[model samples]
Target: MSDAPTTYTGAVKPGGPADVRELGGLTLTKVAVDAQMSNNCYLLRCRSTGEQLLVDAAAEPETLLPLVGENLATVVTTHQHWDHHRALADVVEATGAATLAGEADATAITEATGVPIARTLSHGDTVAVGDCTLEVIALRGHTPGSVALLYRDPEGTPHLWTGDSLFPGGPGRTTTPEDFDSIMSDLQEKVFDKLPDETWFYPGHGNDSTLGAERGSIPEWLARRW
Candidate 1:
Protein backbone atom coordinates (compact mmCIF):
# COMPACT_ATOMS: atom_id res chain seq x y z
CA MET A 1 0.00 0.00 0.00
CA SER A 2 1.04 3.61 -0.57
CA ASP A 3 1.95 6.09 2.14
CA ALA A 4 -0.94 8.33 1.11
CA PRO A 5 -3.91 8.70 3.44
CA THR A 6 -6.46 5.96 2.90
CA THR A 7 -9.32 7.46 4.95
CA TYR A 8 -11.05 10.72 4.00
CA THR A 9 -12.97 12.98 6.37
CA GLY A 10 -14.88 15.48 4.26
CA ALA A 11 -15.11 18.19 6.87
CA VAL A 12 -14.14 21.80 6.17
CA LYS A 13 -14.58 25.20 7.75
CA PRO A 14 -14.63 28.76 6.46
CA GLY A 15 -11.08 29.81 5.51
CA GLY A 16 -10.58 26.15 5.97
CA PRO A 17 -7.89 23.67 6.79
CA ALA A 18 -9.02 22.08 3.50
CA ASP A 19 -9.59 18.36 3.99
CA VAL A 20 -7.89 16.25 1.35
CA ARG A 21 -8.32 12.62 0.28
CA GLU A 22 -6.19 10.42 -1.91
CA LEU A 23 -7.68 7.91 -4.32
CA GLY A 24 -6.25 5.81 -7.10
CA GLY A 25 -4.40 8.16 -9.47
CA LEU A 26 -6.33 11.15 -8.11
CA THR A 27 -6.24 13.55 -5.16
CA LEU A 28 -9.36 15.35 -3.89
CA THR A 29 -9.20 18.56 -1.87
CA LYS A 30 -12.24 20.20 -0.28
CA VAL A 31 -12.12 23.82 0.83
CA ALA A 32 -14.71 26.11 2.41
CA VAL A 33 -14.18 29.57 0.92
CA ASP A 34 -17.39 31.58 1.14
CA ALA A 35 -17.43 32.61 4.77
CA GLN A 36 -21.00 33.86 4.84
CA MET A 37 -22.55 30.93 3.01
CA SER A 38 -19.96 28.35 3.92
CA ASN A 39 -19.82 27.08 0.37
CA ASN A 40 -17.46 24.25 -0.49
CA CYS A 41 -15.06 24.22 -3.43
CA TYR A 42 -13.34 21.08 -4.57
CA LEU A 43 -9.99 20.83 -6.30
CA LEU A 44 -9.25 17.64 -8.16
CA ARG A 45 -5.76 16.83 -9.38
CA CYS A 46 -4.62 14.04 -11.62
CA ARG A 47 -1.46 12.51 -10.17
CA SER A 48 -0.23 11.19 -13.51
CA THR A 49 -0.69 14.30 -15.68
CA GLY A 50 -0.79 16.99 -12.97
CA GLU A 51 -3.91 18.52 -14.52
CA GLN A 52 -6.38 20.12 -12.13
CA LEU A 53 -10.10 20.91 -12.10
CA LEU A 54 -11.96 23.22 -9.73
CA VAL A 55 -15.62 22.68 -8.92
CA ASP A 56 -17.51 25.87 -7.99
CA ALA A 57 -15.34 29.01 -7.84
CA ALA A 58 -17.67 30.06 -5.00
CA ALA A 59 -15.83 32.99 -3.37
CA GLU A 60 -12.49 34.23 -2.05
CA PRO A 61 -10.42 34.35 -5.24
CA GLU A 62 -7.29 35.11 -3.25
CA THR A 63 -7.75 31.93 -1.23
CA LEU A 64 -8.45 29.85 -4.37
CA LEU A 65 -5.79 31.19 -6.77
CA PRO A 66 -2.71 30.09 -4.84
CA LEU A 67 -4.01 26.53 -4.61
CA VAL A 68 -4.56 26.57 -8.40
CA GLY A 69 -0.90 27.26 -9.15
CA GLU A 70 -0.20 27.31 -12.93
CA ASN A 71 -2.02 24.23 -14.19
CA LEU A 72 -5.80 24.41 -14.03
CA ALA A 73 -7.56 22.65 -16.90
CA THR A 74 -11.22 23.37 -16.20
CA VAL A 75 -13.72 24.96 -13.82
CA VAL A 76 -17.15 23.38 -13.57
CA THR A 77 -20.11 25.21 -12.01
CA THR A 78 -22.60 22.76 -10.57
CA HIS A 79 -25.42 25.22 -10.99
CA GLN A 80 -26.19 28.82 -11.90
CA HIS A 81 -26.43 30.01 -8.31
CA TRP A 82 -24.75 33.32 -7.46
CA ASP A 83 -22.88 32.06 -4.40
CA HIS A 84 -21.45 29.09 -6.26
CA HIS A 85 -19.70 31.20 -8.93
CA ARG A 86 -18.94 34.40 -7.06
CA ALA A 87 -15.24 34.14 -7.93
CA LEU A 88 -15.65 32.68 -11.37
CA ALA A 89 -14.45 35.72 -13.28
CA ASP A 90 -11.40 36.17 -11.12
CA VAL A 91 -10.37 32.52 -11.14
CA VAL A 92 -10.85 32.13 -14.89
CA GLU A 93 -8.99 35.34 -15.64
CA ALA A 94 -6.13 34.30 -13.41
CA THR A 95 -5.87 30.74 -14.76
CA GLY A 96 -7.40 31.09 -18.25
CA ALA A 97 -9.06 27.79 -17.48
CA ALA A 98 -12.02 26.55 -19.48
CA THR A 99 -15.47 26.99 -17.88
CA LEU A 100 -18.31 24.45 -17.92
CA ALA A 101 -21.84 24.12 -16.52
CA GLY A 102 -25.15 22.48 -17.27
CA GLU A 103 -26.65 23.55 -20.62
CA ALA A 104 -29.85 25.00 -19.23
CA ASP A 105 -28.12 27.35 -16.79
CA ALA A 106 -25.21 28.52 -18.93
CA THR A 107 -26.78 31.87 -19.76
CA ALA A 108 -27.69 32.61 -16.16
CA ILE A 109 -24.21 31.74 -14.93
CA THR A 110 -22.69 34.03 -17.53
CA GLU A 111 -25.07 36.76 -16.48
CA ALA A 112 -24.11 36.32 -12.85
CA THR A 113 -20.32 36.11 -13.36
CA GLY A 114 -19.65 37.80 -16.73
CA VAL A 115 -17.67 34.71 -17.62
CA PRO A 116 -19.14 32.74 -20.47
CA ILE A 117 -19.17 28.99 -20.08
CA ALA A 118 -16.71 27.36 -22.48
CA ARG A 119 -19.01 24.40 -22.82
CA THR A 120 -22.50 23.53 -21.61
CA LEU A 121 -22.75 20.10 -20.01
CA SER A 122 -25.64 17.64 -20.01
CA HIS A 123 -26.79 14.69 -17.94
CA GLY A 124 -24.61 12.15 -19.68
CA ASP A 125 -21.63 14.35 -20.51
CA THR A 126 -18.11 13.39 -19.52
CA VAL A 127 -15.57 15.89 -18.14
CA ALA A 128 -11.88 15.11 -18.32
CA VAL A 129 -9.52 15.76 -15.46
CA GLY A 130 -6.34 14.72 -17.22
CA ASP A 131 -6.80 10.99 -17.88
CA CYS A 132 -9.72 10.46 -15.47
CA THR A 133 -13.23 11.36 -16.57
CA LEU A 134 -16.21 12.44 -14.46
CA GLU A 135 -19.70 11.56 -15.60
CA VAL A 136 -22.21 14.37 -15.37
CA ILE A 137 -25.67 13.90 -13.86
CA ALA A 138 -28.14 16.74 -14.46
CA LEU A 139 -30.34 17.12 -11.40
CA ARG A 140 -32.95 19.82 -11.54
CA GLY A 141 -34.96 21.34 -8.62
CA HIS A 142 -32.37 23.25 -6.59
CA THR A 143 -31.89 25.08 -9.86
CA PRO A 144 -33.21 24.47 -13.33
CA GLY A 145 -29.74 23.39 -14.41
CA SER A 146 -28.22 21.95 -11.27
CA VAL A 147 -25.76 19.13 -12.01
CA ALA A 148 -23.61 16.58 -10.20
CA LEU A 149 -20.35 14.85 -11.06
CA LEU A 150 -19.70 11.17 -10.41
CA TYR A 151 -16.19 9.76 -10.21
CA ARG A 152 -15.71 6.01 -10.11
CA ASP A 153 -12.34 5.23 -8.61
CA PRO A 154 -10.77 2.16 -10.11
CA GLU A 155 -9.20 1.08 -6.84
CA GLY A 156 -11.72 2.51 -4.39
CA THR A 157 -15.34 3.63 -3.97
CA PRO A 158 -17.40 5.83 -6.28
CA HIS A 159 -17.20 9.50 -5.39
CA LEU A 160 -19.85 12.11 -6.13
CA TRP A 161 -19.98 15.90 -6.08
CA THR A 162 -23.60 16.64 -5.23
CA GLY A 163 -23.54 20.45 -5.29
CA ASP A 164 -26.69 21.70 -3.50
CA SER A 165 -28.89 18.91 -4.66
CA LEU A 166 -28.42 16.21 -2.03
CA PHE A 167 -27.04 16.73 1.46
CA PRO A 168 -26.43 14.58 4.52
CA GLY A 169 -29.96 14.66 5.91
CA GLY A 170 -32.07 15.07 2.81
CA PRO A 171 -32.33 16.77 -0.56
CA GLY A 172 -31.47 20.47 -0.71
CA ARG A 173 -33.94 23.20 0.15
CA THR A 174 -36.43 23.70 -2.64
CA THR A 175 -38.92 26.54 -2.95
CA THR A 176 -42.21 24.95 -3.97
CA PRO A 177 -43.64 21.45 -3.74
CA GLU A 178 -43.04 21.07 -7.47
CA ASP A 179 -39.37 21.87 -7.12
CA PHE A 180 -39.07 19.60 -4.12
CA ASP A 181 -40.66 16.73 -5.97
CA SER A 182 -38.46 17.29 -8.98
CA ILE A 183 -35.21 17.03 -7.02
CA MET A 184 -36.46 14.06 -5.04
CA SER A 185 -37.41 12.22 -8.20
CA ASP A 186 -34.07 12.85 -9.85
CA LEU A 187 -32.18 11.85 -6.72
CA GLN A 188 -34.15 8.63 -6.64
CA GLU A 189 -33.94 7.58 -10.29
CA LYS A 190 -30.57 8.92 -11.35
CA VAL A 191 -28.57 8.85 -8.14
CA PHE A 192 -29.89 6.41 -5.54
CA ASP A 193 -31.16 3.80 -7.93
CA LYS A 194 -28.12 3.80 -10.16
CA LEU A 195 -25.35 4.12 -7.56
CA PRO A 196 -24.18 1.65 -4.95
CA ASP A 197 -24.69 2.25 -1.24
CA GLU A 198 -20.93 2.36 -0.64
CA THR A 199 -20.58 5.48 -2.79
CA TRP A 200 -19.24 8.48 -0.90
CA PHE A 201 -20.57 11.92 -1.85
CA TYR A 202 -19.32 15.45 -1.21
CA PRO A 203 -21.89 18.17 -0.90
CA GLY A 204 -21.63 21.85 -1.81
CA HIS A 205 -21.81 22.97 1.78
CA GLY A 206 -21.11 21.57 5.22
CA ASN A 207 -19.86 17.99 5.78
CA ASP A 208 -20.02 14.96 3.52
CA SER A 209 -22.08 11.73 3.74
CA THR A 210 -22.29 8.43 1.95
CA LEU A 211 -25.23 6.90 0.09
CA GLY A 212 -25.29 4.06 2.59
CA ALA A 213 -25.60 6.46 5.50
CA GLU A 214 -28.42 8.45 3.91
CA ARG A 215 -30.25 5.62 2.14
CA GLY A 216 -32.69 4.85 4.93
CA SER A 217 -33.70 8.49 5.28
CA ILE A 218 -35.15 8.70 1.79
CA PRO A 219 -38.59 7.75 3.02
CA GLU A 220 -38.50 10.37 5.73
CA TRP A 221 -37.26 12.93 3.27
CA LEU A 222 -40.17 12.17 0.99
CA ALA A 223 -42.76 12.24 3.76
CA ARG A 224 -41.57 15.58 5.10
CA ARG A 225 -40.61 17.42 1.97
CA TRP A 226 -38.84 20.70 2.34
Candidate 2:
Protein backbone atom coordinates (compact mmCIF):
# COMPACT_ATOMS: atom_id res chain seq x y z
CA MET A 1 0.00 0.00 0.00
CA SER A 2 2.74 2.40 0.85
CA ASP A 3 4.46 1.82 -2.49
CA ALA A 4 1.30 1.55 -4.59
CA PRO A 5 0.59 4.10 -7.28
CA THR A 6 -2.06 6.58 -6.25
CA THR A 7 -3.41 6.96 -9.76
CA TYR A 8 -3.08 5.67 -13.32
CA THR A 9 -2.78 8.17 -16.17
CA GLY A 10 -3.59 5.49 -18.81
CA ALA A 11 -1.68 7.26 -21.60
CA VAL A 12 0.27 4.82 -23.79
CA LYS A 13 1.55 3.95 -27.26
CA PRO A 14 2.57 0.97 -29.34
CA GLY A 15 5.87 -0.81 -28.73
CA GLY A 16 7.75 0.16 -25.59
CA PRO A 17 6.96 2.41 -22.65
CA ALA A 18 3.79 1.04 -21.11
CA ASP A 19 2.04 2.91 -18.27
CA VAL A 20 2.17 0.78 -15.15
CA ARG A 21 0.06 1.24 -12.03
CA GLU A 22 0.52 -0.84 -8.92
CA LEU A 23 -2.71 -1.05 -7.00
CA GLY A 24 -3.09 -2.87 -3.67
CA GLY A 25 -2.83 -6.44 -4.94
CA LEU A 26 -2.96 -6.05 -8.69
CA THR A 27 -0.50 -4.48 -11.08
CA LEU A 28 -2.03 -2.94 -14.19
CA THR A 29 -0.19 -2.08 -17.36
CA LYS A 30 -1.79 -0.19 -20.24
CA VAL A 31 -0.43 -0.05 -23.77
CA ALA A 32 -1.84 1.75 -26.79
CA VAL A 33 -1.23 -0.17 -29.99
CA ASP A 34 -1.53 0.43 -33.67
CA ALA A 35 -2.40 -1.21 -36.93
CA GLN A 36 -3.42 2.41 -37.12
CA MET A 37 -6.34 1.86 -34.75
CA SER A 38 -4.85 3.37 -31.58
CA ASN A 39 -6.37 0.42 -29.80
CA ASN A 40 -5.65 -0.09 -26.12
CA CYS A 41 -4.52 -3.25 -24.27
CA TYR A 42 -4.26 -3.95 -20.59
CA LEU A 43 -2.21 -6.49 -18.65
CA LEU A 44 -3.37 -7.25 -15.15
CA ARG A 45 -0.88 -9.15 -12.99
CA CYS A 46 -1.33 -10.38 -9.51
CA ARG A 47 1.13 -8.96 -7.04
CA SER A 48 1.08 -11.92 -4.70
CA THR A 49 1.72 -14.71 -7.18
CA GLY A 50 2.37 -13.00 -10.50
CA GLU A 51 -0.61 -14.69 -12.15
CA GLN A 52 -1.34 -12.53 -15.18
CA LEU A 53 -4.44 -11.83 -17.26
CA LEU A 54 -4.59 -9.64 -20.31
CA VAL A 55 -7.51 -7.61 -21.64
CA ASP A 56 -7.53 -7.14 -25.43
CA ALA A 57 -4.42 -8.46 -27.14
CA ALA A 58 -4.91 -5.60 -29.59
CA ALA A 59 -1.61 -5.63 -31.47
CA GLU A 60 2.16 -5.50 -31.36
CA PRO A 61 2.74 -8.78 -29.56
CA GLU A 62 6.45 -8.18 -29.29
CA THR A 63 5.69 -5.18 -27.14
CA LEU A 64 2.98 -6.90 -25.05
CA LEU A 65 4.27 -10.40 -24.39
CA PRO A 66 7.44 -9.31 -22.64
CA LEU A 67 5.34 -7.16 -20.36
CA VAL A 68 3.73 -10.32 -19.05
CA GLY A 69 7.00 -12.19 -18.70
CA GLU A 70 5.84 -15.81 -18.91
CA ASN A 71 2.78 -17.79 -17.86
CA LEU A 72 -0.15 -15.58 -18.73
CA ALA A 73 -3.15 -17.34 -17.24
CA THR A 74 -5.93 -15.77 -19.26
CA VAL A 75 -6.89 -13.27 -21.94
CA VAL A 76 -10.24 -11.54 -22.11
CA THR A 77 -11.59 -9.99 -25.29
CA THR A 78 -13.94 -7.19 -24.33
CA HIS A 79 -15.76 -7.49 -27.60
CA GLN A 80 -15.45 -9.07 -31.00
CA HIS A 81 -14.07 -6.08 -32.86
CA TRP A 82 -11.29 -6.86 -35.29
CA ASP A 83 -9.14 -4.02 -34.07
CA HIS A 84 -9.48 -5.06 -30.46
CA HIS A 85 -8.39 -8.60 -31.16
CA ARG A 86 -5.77 -8.23 -33.86
CA ALA A 87 -3.21 -10.09 -31.81
CA LEU A 88 -5.47 -12.51 -30.00
CA ALA A 89 -4.43 -15.61 -31.83
CA ASP A 90 -0.76 -14.91 -31.48
CA VAL A 91 -1.09 -14.19 -27.80
CA VAL A 92 -3.07 -17.30 -27.04
CA GLU A 93 -0.70 -19.42 -29.04
CA ALA A 94 2.29 -17.96 -27.28
CA THR A 95 1.01 -18.23 -23.75
CA GLY A 96 -1.52 -21.04 -23.93
CA ALA A 97 -3.78 -18.78 -21.97
CA ALA A 98 -7.45 -19.49 -21.68
CA THR A 99 -9.71 -16.85 -23.26
CA LEU A 100 -12.86 -15.14 -22.03
CA ALA A 101 -15.36 -12.77 -23.60
CA GLY A 102 -18.96 -11.67 -23.38
CA GLU A 103 -21.37 -14.53 -24.06
CA ALA A 104 -23.01 -12.85 -27.04
CA ASP A 105 -19.69 -12.06 -28.68
CA ALA A 106 -17.85 -15.30 -27.98
CA THR A 107 -18.73 -16.97 -31.25
CA ALA A 108 -17.88 -13.89 -33.28
CA ILE A 109 -14.58 -13.48 -31.47
CA THR A 110 -13.70 -17.10 -32.13
CA GLU A 111 -14.67 -16.62 -35.75
CA ALA A 112 -12.44 -13.59 -36.02
CA THR A 113 -9.47 -14.73 -33.97
CA GLY A 114 -9.57 -18.50 -34.48
CA VAL A 115 -9.09 -18.90 -30.76
CA PRO A 116 -11.89 -20.31 -28.66
CA ILE A 117 -13.17 -18.66 -25.53
CA ALA A 118 -12.70 -20.90 -22.50
CA ARG A 119 -15.42 -19.02 -20.70
CA THR A 120 -18.20 -16.70 -21.78
CA LEU A 121 -18.98 -14.00 -19.29
CA SER A 122 -22.40 -12.55 -18.59
CA HIS A 123 -23.47 -9.50 -16.59
CA GLY A 124 -22.69 -9.81 -12.87
CA ASP A 125 -20.18 -12.57 -13.50
CA THR A 126 -16.69 -12.11 -12.11
CA VAL A 127 -13.15 -12.69 -13.36
CA ALA A 128 -10.42 -13.53 -10.91
CA VAL A 129 -6.87 -12.41 -11.34
CA GLY A 130 -5.00 -13.92 -8.44
CA ASP A 131 -6.62 -12.39 -5.38
CA CYS A 132 -8.41 -9.56 -7.21
CA THR A 133 -11.79 -9.80 -8.90
CA LEU A 134 -13.20 -7.96 -11.90
CA GLU A 135 -16.93 -7.77 -12.42
CA VAL A 136 -18.35 -8.15 -15.91
CA ILE A 137 -20.92 -5.64 -17.14
CA ALA A 138 -22.79 -6.02 -20.43
CA LEU A 139 -22.91 -2.71 -22.25
CA ARG A 140 -24.86 -4.06 -25.28
CA GLY A 141 -23.96 -1.55 -27.99
CA HIS A 142 -21.27 -0.39 -30.37
CA THR A 143 -21.25 -4.17 -30.67
CA PRO A 144 -23.95 -6.61 -29.65
CA GLY A 145 -21.79 -8.28 -27.03
CA SER A 146 -19.64 -5.42 -25.78
CA VAL A 147 -18.65 -5.75 -22.15
CA ALA A 148 -16.83 -3.68 -19.57
CA LEU A 149 -14.82 -4.99 -16.61
CA LEU A 150 -15.10 -3.28 -13.22
CA TYR A 151 -12.60 -3.90 -10.43
CA ARG A 152 -12.99 -2.54 -6.93
CA ASP A 153 -10.02 -2.58 -4.61
CA PRO A 154 -10.47 -3.01 -0.92
CA GLU A 155 -8.28 -0.01 -0.19
CA GLY A 156 -8.68 2.07 -3.34
CA THR A 157 -11.09 3.51 -5.86
CA PRO A 158 -12.79 1.22 -8.36
CA HIS A 159 -11.45 0.92 -11.92
CA LEU A 160 -13.20 -0.07 -15.13
CA TRP A 161 -12.03 -1.21 -18.55
CA THR A 162 -14.58 0.09 -21.04
CA GLY A 163 -13.76 -1.27 -24.47
CA ASP A 164 -15.46 0.99 -26.99
CA SER A 165 -18.56 1.27 -24.93
CA LEU A 166 -18.06 4.53 -23.03
CA PHE A 167 -15.29 7.08 -23.34
CA PRO A 168 -14.16 10.35 -21.84
CA GLY A 169 -16.53 12.69 -23.66
CA GLY A 170 -19.36 10.35 -24.61
CA PRO A 171 -20.49 6.83 -25.28
CA GLY A 172 -18.70 4.86 -28.02
CA ARG A 173 -19.80 5.31 -31.63
CA THR A 174 -22.94 3.54 -32.77
CA THR A 175 -24.27 2.98 -36.27
CA THR A 176 -27.86 3.88 -35.48
CA PRO A 177 -30.04 5.83 -33.08
CA GLU A 178 -31.37 2.61 -31.64
CA ASP A 179 -27.89 1.32 -31.03
CA PHE A 180 -26.94 4.64 -29.50
CA ASP A 181 -29.91 4.44 -27.18
CA SER A 182 -29.03 0.91 -26.12
CA ILE A 183 -25.46 1.83 -25.22
CA MET A 184 -26.57 5.01 -23.53
CA SER A 185 -29.12 3.22 -21.41
CA ASP A 186 -26.51 0.71 -20.29
CA LEU A 187 -24.04 3.44 -19.47
CA GLN A 188 -26.60 5.33 -17.41
CA GLU A 189 -27.81 2.34 -15.50
CA LYS A 190 -25.17 -0.43 -15.42
CA VAL A 191 -22.19 1.91 -15.36
CA PHE A 192 -22.88 5.44 -14.14
CA ASP A 193 -25.55 4.51 -11.64
CA LYS A 194 -24.11 1.30 -10.23
CA LEU A 195 -20.58 2.63 -9.91
CA PRO A 196 -19.40 5.54 -7.87
CA ASP A 197 -18.15 8.82 -9.30
CA GLU A 198 -14.63 8.08 -8.07
CA THR A 199 -14.37 5.11 -10.37
CA TRP A 200 -11.59 5.45 -12.95
CA PHE A 201 -12.31 3.98 -16.38
CA TYR A 202 -9.99 2.94 -19.20
CA PRO A 203 -11.36 3.19 -22.71
CA GLY A 204 -10.32 1.09 -25.68
CA HIS A 205 -8.92 3.95 -27.73
CA GLY A 206 -7.94 6.97 -25.64
CA ASN A 207 -6.92 8.42 -22.29
CA ASP A 208 -8.49 7.37 -19.03
CA SER A 209 -11.45 9.22 -17.47
CA THR A 210 -13.41 8.99 -14.28
CA LEU A 211 -17.12 8.48 -13.94
CA GLY A 212 -17.29 11.76 -12.05
CA ALA A 213 -15.56 13.62 -14.86
CA GLU A 214 -18.03 12.44 -17.46
CA ARG A 215 -21.19 12.26 -15.40
CA GLY A 216 -22.19 15.87 -15.95
CA SER A 217 -21.97 15.48 -19.70
CA ILE A 218 -24.56 12.70 -19.96
CA PRO A 219 -27.31 15.11 -20.92
CA GLU A 220 -25.12 16.52 -23.66
CA TRP A 221 -24.19 13.01 -24.76
CA LEU A 222 -27.87 12.21 -25.03
CA ALA A 223 -28.58 15.33 -27.02
CA ARG A 224 -25.80 14.71 -29.50
CA ARG A 225 -26.68 11.03 -29.87
CA TRP A 226 -23.19 9.93 -30.77
User: Which tens-of-lDDT digit does each residue in 139-159 have in candidate 2?
Assistant: 998999999998887778888
* Candidate-wise lDDT, in order: 0.92, 0.88
Off by over 4 Å in 2: 1-8
Model 2's alpha-carbon lDDT is 0.88
lDDT of 1 at 165: 98
Model 2 per-residue lDDT at 9: 69
Candidate 1 versus the native: TM-score?
0.97
